[model samples]
Target chain A: MTASTDPATKEPFERVVQAHGDVVWKVCRGLLPQHDAEDAWSETFLAAMRAWDRFDGDRVRGWLVTIAHRKALDVLRAGARVETREDGPPDRAVEPPGRDLDLWAALARLPAAQRAAVVHHHLAGLPHADVAALTGSTPAAVRKAASDGVRRLRALMTEEPR
Target chain B: MTESTPTEAAMPTVPATPPQRLEALHRRLEAAATGDDAPDVHYRHLDSAVGGLLVAATEQGVVRVAFAREGEDAVLQALADRVGPRVLRTPGRLDAAAAWLEAYLAGRRQPFPLALDTRLARGFRLSVLDRLREVPYGERVTYAQLAASADAPRAVRAVGTACATNPLPIVIPCHRVTRSDGSTGAYLGGAEVKVRLLELERTGRLPD
Candidate 1:
């Protein structure tokens, strides 16, 4: 039977995961605070594994990180407390330098779509072209959202100490 | 092929940006990408029983599963960089990953059933990977076979290239792709691992 049609012919996928687990975790940790990082880490690798067959292995690392980053954002959007889940979200610190907490808070306050564009480009470090692919949007639209998100962040971060 | 665009100018300089972290993350991920016993411990803790985590996504009804713990950081960063920082990990998203992995490792499962996240690849490479997934696990195929499956029968060399650059390995089962002479070809996870996987399907042994 052909590989595609034969069920028994599929190779084991765990081997690849055994190969790159740590790389997945660091991406989750970087985006998430200690609290919510683990779940994000797990979700990232899991997502990568499920999609392994269709993945072009040329840039495996890039591919995995992209999934993890998106998954982290999904967690944040759910507003699920980090502690409640296996991979919990990090708690907001009392205060962060440069109004970091305020920035995230403002980001959280913005529309989910806008927040995603800003975070992916500014914090995640993806190129615009790649960003376009991930978000299913045109490069022009991604650029606009990023600009708007940044403007919103700056406004929230630099607001008069009211 | 390796040029940076001018649009990068709009990006700001943040001291704590993910780039530095991604550099370190990439090294660990790449090292871990090699299918060796030792793995990067900086972030992921591997337990063979759990079978490591993976993410499977697809387009056009074909799925690719990428198995790597180290790439997790990179995946998250890619999402953040590509999509947005709003990326958060979903709860129990790994259930499917863990289930398929466990079953595959225990020999209880064959034919990886996964969803594909083909957000990155475009064009021909994507088509090739889709076809690669159809190549059965135990049965080996020549590069010529793969090229033909994709309706590009003459592109045997291109088929080899596509297999070499597959982002997802086992899920796509590129290891099943062998030389025309029936000899084992190179595998990203190593020839031994490839042999072992084949043996596992052929003899049901854990292949030495």
Candidate 2:
């Protein structure tokens, strides 16, 4: 067996997925509904594998988060179309309503930027600059979005249920 | 009301449990990535008379056969690092190789029908492996004789090195090469396995 000393090529793509799958899952869950989140997470890795040879970025987590962000957006856009359809069922059971319903409900209330910022920067432990790159904003904007998102989430998590 | 820091508030409260079907999902992703027009390398461990053996093969052919002494994880990690990162632990991809190995270890003397990727061997060392395959079962050849057959009679030491490093052992029959003084030489799977293989070949049964 050949000893591969080159760090750039040493890490197999499988290892990459195994190392970052949980973080990507959390990011997707924070952005999309749980059911759609799994799909987004799978798509993110598939896409990453396709472009793996060309990936020169040192921050693999950042690169993966960026791909997941785009995939999550695609799922949201598709969900929006189905929601707008007049003939759609009133209670589409795409995901079974479960105990995490309140958590998801609170997350859904946050603005898109705030949710992405909180998930990428706070949950995934990516630097603000990396989150900014993913969100297409400056680092300062991402930091502010994360803080505002957390403040709003605190208020929502503590409010008495109706 | 007690105020919480932004970091404390942003701490992910949702249970981060991995999906129940994570393994299945990984398999599906690997399959999709290898779909049509790519060299897919798949591997799996097989229980054999010797021990657990890790077999890896590409669409081209059986590429590597590793003994358990070296540790399957380390061997697989090396395969992943050296070969393409597209390696997956799917046994179905190695059905042909596994069947051939099972038959061979059971003393069936079946020739490996799969193509081989000898990319790991090159130049004179590769030629040495090619010559090693020609050594008939139950027979033995000294390292010098094998070197002579490879048209490099003076490079007997190099011949030994080639046998020691043969990526596809057993199938390539590197175990048939020995020392010139009528003794078994070094083997990649250790000298004991080499002797056992030779004895199995001669007796048409695994030695007790």
Candidate 3:
């Protein structure tokens, strides 16, 4: 009997995970705190793995970053009312001049629009048009938001680490 | 008021993000992917007495055990080419199989306890493997003897092909079969491995 091979083999899911894992994590971590970012990262991949066949894009990084954006936003909205005293230095802190800055903390302080723009356009390397489509803004607006967010982040990062 | 509020020169650099907890994250995603939507094939490496062996499994059971000679990457691609490409290197799923093989290789005359997926072999080859498994520990059987036992008395050449192509060789005990003149036959894992396996079974100890 001739044992036949599959006519079309799906690309292994592990490859997808390996290829986009870093960018996806960056997008999530840029928008949310460390623990929530970890959760968002996993959620993004689980959703991707489940809907692998339905994946319709050649731009895999864009797709994963979009999913990560959603998960991170979900955490923000879920905890908007309850004061989540996250474990670390306060969301806004000032300390010794030479101390390193907490990037996640700086990211957490940005307004939602700026945060999304920076995460999608800068960290995820998505074009401004894609970020605009994801965030309901125009490409020009996305570019402005990302630059403004970067300016604010640089300022906040000068204060303190913990 | 200004983009230069904290000049690039003055701003403290963000501490390097802690090393990613990728191993843990991978486990979580792999677990979720292996849900009702679709099952994934998981594989792991086992350093045995002979060499590094790759053991792969479907959700049902251990499917393929390949020697390092096969090239681990090529074996994985072949598995993906044949058995849908939803594969991951999740070692936790193969605990039972790993433990059993480790015990067997370490001179514990353990019965083959892991479930086997023999879907890779078909027809006469499948039957030959089935018959070969009953050749007890420390025993030897020529291809003709195994072919006869499988009730295909005239199919000695086919029997050799079956044993050579056996996907689960050491686990299926194809190492027990030899050539008609009592020479170690052509094994998929090489004849030297066959000799070593036979010695292990015969004396219950591996030679250095």
For every model in order, what is the iRMS?
A: 13.7, 5.1, 5.9
Q: Which ten residues in a row have the lowest lDDT in candidate 2 chain A?
A: A82-91
Model 2, C-alpha of A85: deviation from truth (Å):
13
lDDT of 1 by residue, B52-168 (tens): 544433212222343454366554444333322222222223455555655665565373656655545557777888887676656888888888888999988888888776765
Error of 1 at A75 (Å): 20
Q: Which stretches of candidate 3 lie over 4 Å from their true place?
A: A1-7, A54-56, A81-101, B1-20, B30-38
The local distance difference test score of model 1 is 0.54
Query: Per-residue lDDT for A29-143 in model 2, tens only?
Result: 7787656777888788888876665666677888898899999989988877332122123213433344355455566678888888877877677888888877789999988
Instruction: Give Cα distance to truth, residue A142, candidate 1, Å.
Output: 39
Q: What is the lDDT of candidate 3?
A: 0.75
Q: In order of the candidates, what TM-score does chain B achieve?
A: 0.61, 0.84, 0.86
lDDT (CA) per prediction: 0.54, 0.75, 0.75
What shift in Å separates residue B109 of candidate 2 from its native position after superposition? 1.9
TM-score (all chains, Cα) for each model: 0.40, 0.79, 0.83
Task: Tell me the deviation in Å of residue A115 in model 2.
Answer: 2.3
Per-candidate DockQ values are 0.04, 0.30, 0.37
Comparing 1 with 3 on TM-score, the higher-scoring candidate is: 3
User: Which candidate do you rate higher for DockQ, 2 or 3?
Assistant: 3
Best by DockQ: 3
